[model samples]
Target: MLQAREGTCNWKANAASGMAVHDDCKLRFLELKAKRTHRFIVFKIEEKQKQVVVEKVGEPTQNYDDFTASLPVDECRYAVYDFDFVTAENCQKSRIFFIAWSPDTSRVRSKMIYASSKDRFKRELDGIQVELQATDPTEMGLDVIKSRAN
Candidate 1:
């Protein structure tokens, strides 16, 4: 088994949960233990509106309300899927802040999400919603956010 560097793994459990080799890329999976401590929110680009819509996957709460934001769609190059959390009953308590846009218009991918963190992750979605509003898509790319424990 591979070992996780200290502070790299956020969960209460050990970090280096599993590993896989895909061609030239080596992938490591973070293991978030039980307790329904994290939340899951999803955002997809609205091509027609030239914006992004963010919504919580489950029951709505003060912290998990839906939100919408405008982006520099023409300037955005791509939407990258950095990582995902696989939870039971789909009760995610952490916020995965991965939405980002590249300034290089030539990249032309439209949307991107780059979430970076380890176990016990529990970042709030509402907070991210606010951040997205202030973010200038053209100037910021590759922002690493986290999923937090409830």
Candidate 2:
């Protein structure tokens, strides 16, 4: 298992719930947010490693549906999406959202881990405009996202 080290402090010791956010997770998010190289990114905690990792990356051309579909039906995940929409004024706008996907059917332990580590992981990815926690698909639907974006 890989351990993240910063100065003399082990990430596991300083991080919330002893879970560390992997460096690649932040790097990938920067690519998506700053460079617009990706539409979204799915992240999962490796139980054995006790670290958050990038599980998948949606291509720039992928739609919101694709981002939603990437999440497992019975698993907990962390994701970031670049949401684009037109405001009531007909002006185009974009928002970067940090989504916490914890479905009802997922294991309780998984949910606990994700819930505990979310803040630590989120802090690594700079410039997230909104945060959404969804227990079902409907909670993160396009309409809901658009409302949040506006």
Candidate 3:
């Protein structure tokens, strides 16, 4: 049987979930942040590897629809989106949103794992302004995001 090594820095595993956040996840996030190289990123837990991995990165030109379309209909995922909007004062602003998507149709086990690992994962990304959890598409619709941005 495989046993977890305590205090090992190589895998950044969370004690409660035994899930590690892959290094590339943070690296890609940095690119999106410092360079404006990406519009969004999608993350998923690889059950077999017990690690959270970067599954997709949306191009800078991609829209909200592209981000929404990236999420699986029957799975749980973690994502970060750079949302741009015009405020009431006509100021153009952008906010980095961290979204936890656990669709109702996903397996309970998957939902629980993602929930347990979310805090640890998000803590590593640094600079996320808004956090949203959704169990359905409507819960994360553009209108909802716009409201949250304000």
Candidate 4:
């Protein structure tokens, strides 16, 4: 439980119809439950160009569709994923917003994923394509962002 000092949880289970309800209050409650997933990146994609400076490490998107961030989540830290030169399945086709995190408790080793789907964003990853890697980023929290110890 991650909760605001003066907050509460309201999980409404959608029964009878086998569905889900995203009430405003319920959404707030979900936010309260958010864990400080370390070092996860969230990119805001724009149309018609390569604005990032990362080495081409994967394929590109087809049917290019640029998207903006609906909201900024504190857990999401943005890092550019430059796929300009990549011969991906959909290069220059679909705009990509990469998000990654460490799905581990110890932080000694972790799994990282870079996906285009918002559902796969660093803040909320459920089912999406991701590239996993091993690294320790426990020290990569807000403090690290604020500190210039490089």
Q: What is the TM-score of each candidate against the true structure?
A: 0.22, 0.88, 0.89, 0.19
Model 1: per-residue lDDT, tens digit, 1-150? 245654455552232222111211111111111222233333333445433344223222213222122333444312212223345678544433434443444233332321111111113221332133123442333232333221
Candidate 2 segments whose C-alpha is farther than 4 A from its true place: 1-17
State the weakest 10-residue window (summed lDDT) of model 3: 1-10
Give per-residue CA lDDT, model 4, range 37-112, as digits (tens).
Answer: 1112233322133121121122223211121122122222233222122233544421122334333442231111
Query: Candidate 3 local accuracy as lDDT?
Result: 0.93
What are the lDDT scores of the predictions, listed in order?
Answer: 0.29, 0.92, 0.93, 0.26
**Candidate 3 at residue 40, lDDT?**
100
Superposed on all Cα atoms, the candidates' RMSDs to the truth, in angstroms, are 16.9, 6.3, 5.2, 16.9
Query: Comparing candidate 2 with candidate 3, which one achieves the higher lDDT?
Result: 3
Off by over 4 Å in 1: 1-38, 59-107, 111-150
Query: Highest lDDT, which number?
Result: 3
TM value for model 1: 0.22
Cα lDDT for residue 105, model 3? 99
lDDT (10s digit) by residue, model 3, range 3-117: 5454564355545558888999999999988898999999999999999999999999999999999999999999999999999999999999999999999999999889889
Q: List, residue by residue over 107-142, the lDDT tens digit for candidate 2.
A: 999998898889878888999999999999999999
Model 3 steric clash pairs? none
Please report the TM-score between candidate 2 and the true structure.
0.88
- The local lDDT score (0 to 100) that residue 72 gets in candidate 3 is 98
